[model samples]
Target: MGIAGVLEDARPAAAMVVVEFIFSALQIFIKLALDDGMDVRVLVAYRLMFGAAFLCPVAFLIERKKRPPLTVKVVTGLFLCGLFGITINQNLIVLAIKLTNSTTIVTALSNLTPQSTFIVAILSRMETLKLKKPSGRAKLTGTLVGLGGAMLLTFYKGPEMKFLRNLGHTGLSHAQGSHQQLRPPPAEGSRILGSFLAITSCFSYAIWLTIQAKVGQVYPCHYSIAAMVCLFGAVQSTLLALCLHRDTDHWRLGLNIRLYSSAYAGIVASGSAFPLMSWCLRKKGPLYVAMFGPLIIVFVAVMSSIVLDENLHIGIVLGAVLIVAGLYMVLWGKAREEDEQEADEPKAKAVGQDEELGKETTAVNGES
Candidate 1:
């Protein structure tokens, strides 16, 4: 490939790394805000609102010509996407952070996306199950292994790594390193409840991915679709927050950590991350996009330990390794299948050309 071609591919990969780093930082920020007593619902509402506002004008400016008229079906799909992708996922994530810690949440999220999405695709018939093929078997096994790893991470909290035991905070906190519990009163039940919520959120996110594929096929405008999803997500989350949080105290956002967290989550994670990921998805296939998720786990593990004072547990490390291993197995299998298909294309074309030549010769013989 030419230098220009190499640069073109390099850009998206670089962008994805930056996106993961931003997202990793966002997790810590969200934890900080919650630790500062920001209600999860209220936090979600503000994040969605800010994200929607950020994206609306950009979508209007760039995709106005390409944007299609909104049909009821498209609108409904967008609504569902918001409900599952933004509202449920983010809410559960915050709650999980409240219950457990950011490192655990990131570990659960490490390599589950592809496995969950693949399972959903098979059930929905969006992806075929070719059991005879090695790719199909590898995907199946990998999905199981990934799920098992997540389960291990949730159920098993081994002793902290000895080397990382005495590490100090990375000074990401603003309040003189005071780490207070900002979550609900239930502390003992956190591990069990948090694990369930985290796993459920993964499933909900997978469903959103399946629906997004269908929506993309119909609308085909990435920015416009993202804007609509954010708009609807803001409305849904706000309503939910109002119903649950009647106390205006929880919604108060002064010039504190709460305000900063909401701003970063909105502008950086939601608003900026979505469009950037969408562009990467378009440029590099879903597998390429999925390959970058493990990077979040690495970033989160190191950052969480330093910033949030979270322990680096042996179980988390072991489970993360298994999850990533299974992820690569599935990706390698799919890549091999794609390569085989590409290799056969030339032979198929050659056969077609030969048939055409024989027909032409027969026609000439008849003419003679």
Candidate 2:
């Protein structure tokens, strides 16, 4: 209606677009870094460490006044959040991307988060459903469609689409320290392992989302929660890196793309994106926020093709289309439900007001 109103409405859309693009770039950067022989665990460890370093100060500066006492319950939730959200989620995704060499596949499958979150909510009794209702049916249908799309992306590798052939391999490739050269794909075993990892990461992310919702309710300070999670994740990942990548060589960082990629992933992807998503979840609910998940797929698909020399297959194109469609369907259903609820509120309030007026009239007539 007004400038303020329009800007307010556009904020979430803008945030989604910005975050997704940052993530797309992060994926490409991380892949390039890994291709340069950066250890996965070390990369993730640095990412969380830098993320915490950035987030902790901001949380203290901004949410310091609003920060509540950390109870055992909140601390425990943050620990689990870090474990699932950062440790498992990041590890699986990195492995997936390494093996598959397709950020498109990774992100496309991530669109399953809404469906997984919905199921997790139901199981945890956080959400109730009436399958007989239009809203319920719509949600179920959307979930199925989204899952189907994910499956297609995971298993089916159709021929590359001809329309996009003209784009060429514009991305700088890394092969044995050679920059701007085309790199070959990994073995079939690696691909299979990466696909499995990606699928598992999706479910892990859904569980993280569910737990994040619960934690957000008890502790409304989004920045603080994100900071704490990053801290815990940093600790966990560092330990794992120490144990698994025991080489002192693995810990060393050079003035190379590895440093740049880790910095971007930490500052932009984790530091900024997590807090924004948490706030959005608090304001708009998880489904509303999750609907924007498809943007990452689109961004990654284009960026991966250009930056990583990743190809787009027919299955990927088809799966992305289905996932986007399902995203809109679920969002539409949620909007309809909200509209119906809002409509009923006015009618209920009017009835109460009319009843009160009638009672006042009766009292006046008796007094007269």
Candidates' lDDT values, in order? 0.81, 0.81
Each candidate structure's TM-score, on Cα atoms with residue i matched to residue i, is: 0.87, 0.85
List candidate 2 stretches off by more than 4 Å. 1-12, 162-165, 171-183, 275-288, 339-368
Cα RMSD (angstroms) for every candidate in the order listed: 3.7, 4.4
- Could you tell me how far off, in angstroms, the CA of residue 5 lies in candidate 2 after the best superposition? 6.3
Question: Which model scores highest in TM-score?
Answer: 1
lDDT of 1: 0.81
* The 10-residue segment with the lowest total lDDT in model 2: 171-180
Give lDDT tens digits, candidate 2, residues 232-306.
Answer: 999999999898888778887878988898898999888878777766766777666767777787777777666
User: Candidate 2, TM-score vs. the true structure?
Assistant: 0.85
> For candidate 1, what is the TM-score?
0.87
